[model samples]
Target: MNILCVCGNGIGTSVLLKVNVESVAADLGVDVNVTTSDAGSAKGTANMNDLVLTSAELAPELEGT
Candidate 1:
């Protein structure tokens, strides 16, 4: 499975969430690839992942992906 964590800056919250998600996935024995992206970068790329995580404000931006 693939996961994409999105945020405005891509260096702080998204990165932290990526680590936490990975840790939890590891504990559950799920091998998944995780990615971190900002709003702009995620536009065309979000559809490639199985899931996307982001704040409510940013969530709409990823709509229809």
Candidate 2:
């Protein structure tokens, strides 16, 4: 699975989430690709991704997906 963790700055909170997700994947013995991206970059990017993880305020932007 491909997971994208997003935040305003795409540094602190996103990085923390990425670490936790990685630990969970390790315990489950699953192979996944995790990435961190800024909300702006994520919005502008044209590439396809499996999922978007973000705060409640940001959720609405990704609702249709």
Candidate 1: TM-score?
0.96
- Given candidate 1, what's the lDDT at residue 19? 97
TM-score per model over all chains:
0.96, 0.83
User: Model 1, residue 30: what's the lDDT?
Assistant: 99
Model 1 misses residue 37 by how many Å?
A: 0.6
lDDT of 2 by residue, 1-65 (tens): 89888887889888999999899999999898999987777775414677778889876665655
Per-residue lDDT of candidate 1, residues 1-65 (tens digit): 99999999888999999999999999999999999998889988999999999999999899999
**lDDT for every model?**
0.95, 0.80
The residue ranges of model 2 lying beyond 4 angstroms of the native Cα positions read: none
Q: Any idea what lDDT model 2 has?
A: 0.80
After TM-score superposition, the amount by which residue 37's alpha carbon in candidate 2 deviates from its true location, in angstroms, is 0.6
